[model samples]
Structure formats: C-alpha cells, structure tokens
Target: MKQGVLLIAVLTLNGCSSISPQECEVGDWFAIGKTDGQQGIASSKFRSYQKECAEHGLGSDFKAYEQGHAEGVLLYCTYDAGRELGQSGGAYNKVCTGALEPTFRLGYDRGRKWYQAESALLNLQKTLEQNAGTIEKLEQRIDDNTRELSVLKDKQQKQNLLDENRNLLQDLRQLNQMQGQLQRDLKQAELQFSLIQQGG
Candidate 1:
C-alpha cells in the first residue's frame, strides 16, 4: 500500500508540473481527464497538462482527474466500443486492464480483421466492375470496326481495322483474366469476413 501510494504520488507530481494557463484558470481537471479517457488518450497526457499548468503557477487536481478517468474508461472499454474503434482503424491506447482488457482486445482484433477483409472485397468488386466496363467499350469498338471493315473498299483501311480489332481482342482477354482473379479474391475475402463475424 505504501509503494502504491508512492507511485501515485510520483505520477501526480510528474503530471502536475506542466499545466496550461487555460487549464489552470478553468480548474476543470475532472472533465479534461474524462474527455481524454473517452478519446483513448494516454495517461501521460496528464503529466504534460501538469507541466503546462505548473508553468502558470497552478497545480493539477489528480484525485478529481483519476475519478473522472475511471468513469470515462468504463464507457471506452466496452466490447462494442472496441469493435467500432478497430473497424475505424484506430489504434488501441491500452488504457484498459484486468479481465475487461482481454474481452475488448478480442473484439478489436476481430473487428479490424473484418474491416480489412471487407475493404479488400469492396476494392476487388470495384475493379471487376471497371474491367467489365472496359470490356463493354472494347466490344462496342470491335463491333463498329467489323462493320466498318466490311463496308470499306480500300484494302489498306480494311487491314488497319482488322489489326485494331485484334488488339481490342487481346485487351479484352487480359481484362477477362483480371476479372476472374478479382472475383476469386472477392470470394475469399467474403468468406474470411463471414467467418470472422460468425466466430467473433
């Protein structure tokens, strides 16, 4: 108990020395700590605040801050909150401890994975759609060229049209290959995402 008290005192002192002028005057340390905790900010921020306040000849209210931080952490450390943060690609602040930490971490990990997979799937599908659009344009060009080739009296122009058609066909083939690969990737990502959602 003595050691713990010493540690707390040290932390308080370290955080108390750097208080900002505004914070010193406002003296709303509890609200500041609560906001910090809700935003998943590090506890070290208090130390910085302490220093800022100290420069203004003010002291930090460590006890009020701690009480508010605990209350804010309860809101932040929920499983749903963890999942939302992870899905949004936010980093863990590691403020939670004990049993709650494990559960929140589990949600974060799964949510992050799920978010990544979902994003991948969306990108693949979009690429596939773009490839399809390209293919459609290519087909239109091919048809137009074929018709033009048939009606053309000049041999040179007909040959040129034939060559263009061949090139279009080649591009179409490559796009088809890309579309197939994207479809496969989307399928795999979807499966993984589904599994994560179900398992979690």
Candidate 2:
C-alpha cells in the first residue's frame, strides 16, 4: 500500500494522473491505479485517451497511447511480482482487459479495411482512366492511318489515269506519222506516171 501510494504520487507529480471532471480533453494521459480502481480510470483516463486519439492523427494517438501502455504494463508487472515472487500491492493482470477493448478493436479493424478498399477503388479508377487515354490515342492513330491510306489510293488512281493518257498520245502520234508517209508516197508515184506519159 505504501509503495503503491508512493508510485501514484510520483506519477501524479509527473503529470500522468491529470484528470478532468467535466469533460475529457485531448493531449492528456489517463492513468489507472489500483488504489483508484478501474472504474475511475475508465471514466476519466480512458475517455481522455479516446478523445485525444480520435481527434489526432493515427501515429500521433499511437505514440500518445504508448506511454499509457507502458504505464499499465509496469503496473501489471508490479502487481504480478507481489502475487508470484514477492509482496507488492498493485494490478497484476497480464493485459488491461478493459470493457471497451473488444468493441474499439472491432471498429478499428473495420475502419482500416474500409479505407483500404476505398484506396484500391481509387487506384483502379486512375488505371482505367490511363488505359482509356491510351485507347483514344490508338484510335486517333488508326483514323489518321486510314485517312493517309485513302489519300494514297486517290493518288494511285490519278497516276494510273495519267499513264493511260500518255499511252493514248503516243499512239495518236504514231498514226499521224504513218498518214504523212502515205501522202508523200502517193505524190511521188503520181510524178513518176506523169514522166512516163511525157516520154511516150
């Protein structure tokens, strides 16, 4: 009893036993002493811890609770020493085993899972958006290729028409040359007959 009182006094001087009567505030440590019992700690210290934990960041609250866990573990070990090895009066439970522990644990697990799922869904949406952009670019490329191919076909048709026109012009020139040669040959033959008549 003397050692427990001395420990509580020392902790109180160290600012670990700060308790608010009206409401639990943030950034405060809640302490449970066997002398004060679990009821007092639950009502005061646990409320303060929970309020701070909820209002603060995850890592922040975990860091804050680390001190409390350490204190509790120390108290547990202190009591265990008495019941097993030596005589010292304090809480000896291996764990705090609070009433709200189970409920809070379940809620934390659910919240963590929900956040993970939300994160996955957000990532999936981003991936899908990127894939959609890639598909759009590919479609644009295909359309451009199709337009280029159409232009090439049109150019080929025009070239084929030009070649056909050139072949027809060549044929027309050959015909004109043959007609001129025939006319010249006829004139020469006519001249030769005229010369024969004259001779006769």
Candidate 3:
C-alpha cells in the first residue's frame, strides 16, 4: 500500500510538471535549467523540478543547474528580447538585473506603449461595429412594426404595437448617439496607434 501511494504521488507530480518522468530518470539538470532561464523562467522553478524529481527518487544537481542558468539568463536579458516580449503582450518576470535590467526595461516600455495603443484602437473598432449592428437591427424592427400596424384590425393590439414602436424609436435614437460617440473614439484611437507606429 505504501509503494502504491508513492507511485501515485510521483505520477501526480509528473502530470503537474513540464518535466517528464523520463527526464527525471535521465537527470540532465543543467540543460533543463538553461532552457528555463533562456525562456526567462523564475529561479523558483528549480524548486518545482526538485520536488518532482524527488518524488521519483531522483537527485538534482543544483550547482550545475545554477551555473547553466546564469549563462542562459544573459541571452534572455536583452533589449531585443524585451521589445519582442512586450510587443506580444507577454508579462515580464523581472529576471534581468543591474545594467541589463535598464536596457531591457527601456525597450519593453516603448513596445508596451505601442501594444496598448494598438489594442485600444482594436477595441474601439469592435465597439463601433457592434453599435452599428444594433442600430440596423433597431431600424429593421421599427419598420416591421410600422408595416404590421398599417394593416391591423384589433384596436388593443394596434395600441400595443404603437407603444412598442415608440420604445423602439427611443432605443434607436440612443444607439445612434452611441454610434457617433464610438466613431469619435475610434478616430482618436486610430491616430494614437498611427503615432505609435511612427515611433512617436
């Protein structure tokens, strides 16, 4: 029963970890650490690997892993890497230090502004599209109601239709106002995005 429980625990840990059971068996700690560092993964990630490997009765080489990670992190902590990451809306882990941190952060900040401007423009465009679609639907509904009212014989039903048309017309006016506001917002957003694209 104890062995079965241990096996289950190992399996569960392996499932949660990116490191496979086969990787634990092979025990290439340095390479794993290097890959993680190059990807800007946190130092705490090593502890997770330790735990997963320990569950499988394997030993990890911390010294070798740390050495490899130090070298790999140099490659990750670059201006180009930071710019690409920020442009893609990736989160920074604050892994870079000292002089490296400043350079990377400068690129990251610039790219982040561009990304935000682009995102704002896209959101405004989407809202404008939705507003236009709603306005079109409201107009269609009002027209249909008007047509039905023209040929109606029941007085009570005709009154209900008239009331509904009034509400629909009010809604349509509000939606048109919203559409105009969205268009103005979209134009501003587009101008901001264009400025960012031009490196302003």
Candidate 4:
C-alpha cells in the first residue's frame, strides 16, 4: 500500500527538494514555504519540530485534531521565530543547504532547545488553565456589569418622577375606588412597596 502524504509543499520550493515526490508523499504532511530567516515556514525548522514531537512521545496514533494542535503550537513558534529574524536584520542569516537544492534558510541557530516532552505537555496544560481562568473572570465581570447597569437603569428611570409618581397615584386611586377585599389587598401591596422603597 502507498504511504499517504499530507505535506502541503509550497510551489516556490517544491523543485528544491532532492526527495522524490514519492518519498515526500510518504510523510504525513509538509507545510512548505521559504521562511526568509524573516518569514514563512522554512524547511529545516519543520523537520526539527517533527523530530521534537516524535521525541516528546506525542505518539504516532494521535488523531488529526491532536496533530493539528501540535502543529499549531509549532506554527506559533515558527511565526515568532520569523518575526525575530526580521527584526534582527538577518541576525541569523539564511544558509542554503543541500547544494543540489537551496532550502529557504530559517531556524533558531542557537543551540536547539527542545522542552522535554513532559514539559511541553505541561505547558499546554497551563495554557489551557490560564485561558479558562481568563474566560471565567471575564464572564463574572460581564454579569456584574449587567447587574450594575440594571440598577442604574432603575434609578435613572426614576428621574421621570412626575410621570411615574403620577402613574403610581393613578393606580392607587383606581385601586382605592375598587370595592371590598380587592381594594384592601391593593392598598396593602402599595403600602408594602412604599415601606420597602423608603427603606422601612
């Protein structure tokens, strides 16, 4: 059976690879692009990441989403690396390797620092926790603001004192005019509300 390939090779660098298309297809995926020690997904970096993840024991059986997340983390790293290179003015100059093909030079030239797979896993967990905390705090703040706004609205609505008082008086007058038990009940309710509003 043919090994399935998922690499998204960039057209600009496709011709630069010594690997036959068949050999390239054997890998799960390759997001190809010439990262100018300044931008894009440079080849060497991605291969190093593949090795990093493999070393981390992310295991070969993971699903697409897990793999995608891993990829996302790596992508974030790649983007940041590219930005740093851009600012440094080619502090890490691009080096064309594989004389037959010139891969867009990109990567951390500093001694490679791969977090132990355990540390990487922990970092992901911490990120999730921090995100969750941030969401909860925001939600609580929103709810508090909503409650405060409602109180403010109630007070502001009171500014129409003439109209509202007029309405309340009219309602009371109507209730007063009602016969018997219902009238007594309405008056009692009005008295209770007045007491509460007046802070007893």
Candidate 5:
C-alpha cells in the first residue's frame, strides 16, 4: 500500500491560504494552470503555487503549466466570453494579448452598454411606480378633506378646506406630468435595449 504525504503549509497570502496539502501532493500543475487561464487570471498567480509547493519541498512543472495555460486562455479570449464578463460586471484580467484584445474589448463594451440600458429602464419604471403611489395618497387625502368640507356649516372652515383641496389637485397634476416624462424615458431606454439586442 502507498502512503499519502500531508503537504499543507499554514502560509497566508492577503489573510488567506488558498491551497490544501492534498493539492500540493497531487502536483497537477497542468490542470491548475489551465483552470487559472480559463478563469482569466494573471501570470503572477503562479507565484502562489510556487510558494505553497516550496513549503512541501516540491517544485512545480513550469513548462507544462505554461503550455496548458496558453491553450486554455484561447477559449477565454472569445467575444461571447467577454460579453458575459461585462454583463456580470466582472473585471478583465488583462490576460489576452496582441491579436485577441481588440475583439474582446469590443464585445465587452457592447454588453456593458446593454446592461446600462436595462438598468436605466428599471429605474424609470420604479420612479413611475413611486410617483403613482404618491398620487394615490394625495387623491385619498383630497377625497377625505372634500367629504369633511361638504358637511361643514361654517363658511370660513369650508373655504379653507376648498383651498387645501385645490392645492392637492395642483400637486397631483405636477406628479402626473413628471410621470409622463418618466414613461417617455422608459420607452426610450427600452428602444435602446431592443436595438442593442438586435445588433448583437
């Protein structure tokens, strides 16, 4: 029977230790590198493995790791991948170089613009709903006050209530106007979003 060695080192980087002892013992450097590359991690990530492996008196296969990483990054440097990253608001790791960077950046920009348009549309809708609630509350108040005014026999009190109701009406009109403008804005955002989707 073969015995497994415990290779864990309680070494910390930025307040956390990333690799377990079993990872060091298995020494699957190619797979590790491929994963990091696909995830768009920077080359400097290898230092973390180097530091951990050194603690266990082992060394990494740098040539094999780099070879696998180079292959894996090819998939990460695609248009759809870039767009997905942008839509998720994830940062680019700046791993793609030379021939790939320009195309990926273009896709990222398009996706980010789409996300912004969607966000703007939602905000406009929320504002419109809030305005509607405010208008409802104001209308309810006006109705209550008008009912009270109708039964009042005192001339001065009835006149005051009438003036208050008039003010409420004016406020309701302004809110309606603002709501109209927000609706227009929402339409424009939706149109822009649709255009983006069509273009993509």
Candidate 6:
C-alpha cells in the first residue's frame, strides 16, 4: 500500500511538472523563456524551471533566457493582445513597461469593462429564467392541489389541501410580481450592454 501511494504521488508530480526530462536534456532555455514571456507568465516561473531541470542534472542559461524573454514580451504587450486577454477574462501580469504599458492598460481596461457589462446582463437573464420557471412550478402545484381538494372526501384532508393551495397562490402572485420586475431589469441591462458594445 505504501509503495502504491508513493508511486501515485510520483506520477502526479511528474504530470504536473512543466518541463519534461527530454526538454531539460535539449536545454533550449531561450525558446522556453520566450514561450513563457509570450504567454505572459511571471519571471518567477524561471525558478520553477531551474528546480525541475536540476532534478535531471541540467542547468539553465539565465542570460539567454532573459534576452529571449525580453523580445517575446514586446510581442505580448501590444494593445490588441491586452484587449483580447481582458475580453477572455484573463489576468494581466503587469509585464509591459514604459510606453507599451499605457496602451496595453488602456485596451485591457476597456475590454474588461465590456466583459463585466456582458456578464451582468447574462446573470440578469439567468435570474429571469429561474424566476419564470419557479412561477410556473408554483402555478402548476396550485392547480394540482385545487383539483385534489375538490375530490377529497375527508374533511381535514380537504381543508389541508385548501390551505396548501392558498399558500401556493400567494407565492405564485409574489413570483409573478418578481418576474415582471426581472423583465424590466433585463431590458435595462440589454440596453446597457448594447451601449457598451457600441462604445458609448
């Protein structure tokens, strides 16, 4: 059992390791760094690579890696890249510097705002759907209980069903009012999302 647990742990660690044994042997530190930078991965990730490579008795070239990363960062820090990342709800690593940072941030913020507006509209729509479904269920239950009440011969059972139906009707009325309000809110959210889409 202990051996099995140890084997599983080793397999899990190997699966999660970013660098493979073959990659460590090839020692393409520059390309690895460039890829990380292009993906907006943090500089600290190099330490993780170092640790993993060390396990394979390999050492990384920091100078070559840094040079490659700087070049790759230039490609990653564009306004369009930032906008696309923000739109996809991706986090910024604050990698862009000097002149590049401002434009990237501007695009990211605008895209992020649009994303938030769209998310809000979707949430409201989902709530409206749930409210309508609940109202329908309550109405159906009230109808079923009313029919059962009419056919029930026992006095106490009939009275209990009547009470249950009365509560259900009250709940249905409240839900109807909520549904109306949700419809209004949805319309407003839709208008807001439209405005955002139009860059208003």
lDDT of 3 by residue, 96-152 (tens): 888789878877887898889988988888888888888898899989999999999
Better of 1 and 4 by TM-score: 1
Candidate 3, residue 129: the lDDT equals 85
Off by over 4 Å in 3: 1-16
Writing each residue's lDDT as its tens digit, candidate 4 over 56-112 gives: 543232243234434443433453454344334454433332431122233332211
- Candidate 2 has which clashing residue pairs, if any? none
List lDDT for all candidates, in order: 0.76, 0.43, 0.78, 0.40, 0.77, 0.77
Q: Using Cα atoms with residue i matched to residue i, what is each candidate's TM-score against the true structure? A: 0.75, 0.30, 0.84, 0.21, 0.78, 0.85
- Per-residue lDDT over 45-159 for candidate 1, one digit per residue giving the tens place of the 0 to 100 score: 7777777778778888878778778777877787877887788878875888886698788778877987887788888888888889999999999999998887899999999
For candidate 1, the clash count comes to 15
Residue-wise lDDT of candidate 6 within 153-176, one digit each (tens)? 999998898888888888888888
Candidate 3 has what TM-score?
0.84
Q: After superposition, how far is residue 92 of candidate 4 from its true place, in Å?
A: 24
Candidate 1, 87: how far from true, in Å?
Answer: 1.7
Candidate 2 lDDT tens digits, 1-200: 44435545654564654333212322233233332332123223445545544554321233444555555544443322223221112232224346534443343444444444444445555555554555455455545555555666577765665565556556555655554554555455555545533532
lDDT of 5 at 68: 64
**Candidate 1 TM-score versus the reference:** 0.75
Q: What's model 6's TM-score?
A: 0.85
lDDT of 2: 0.43
Q: List the residue pairs that clash in candidate 4.
A: 6-29, 7-29, 7-30
Q: Which candidate number would show the highest TM-score if scored against the true structure?
A: 6
TM-score for candidate 5, please give it: 0.78
What is the model-wide C-alpha lDDT for candidate 5? 0.77
Clashing pairs in 3: none
RMSD per candidate (Å) reads 7.8, 38.3, 6.7, 24.5, 5.2, 7.6
Cα-lDDT of candidate 4: 0.40
Highest-scoring model, lDDT: 3
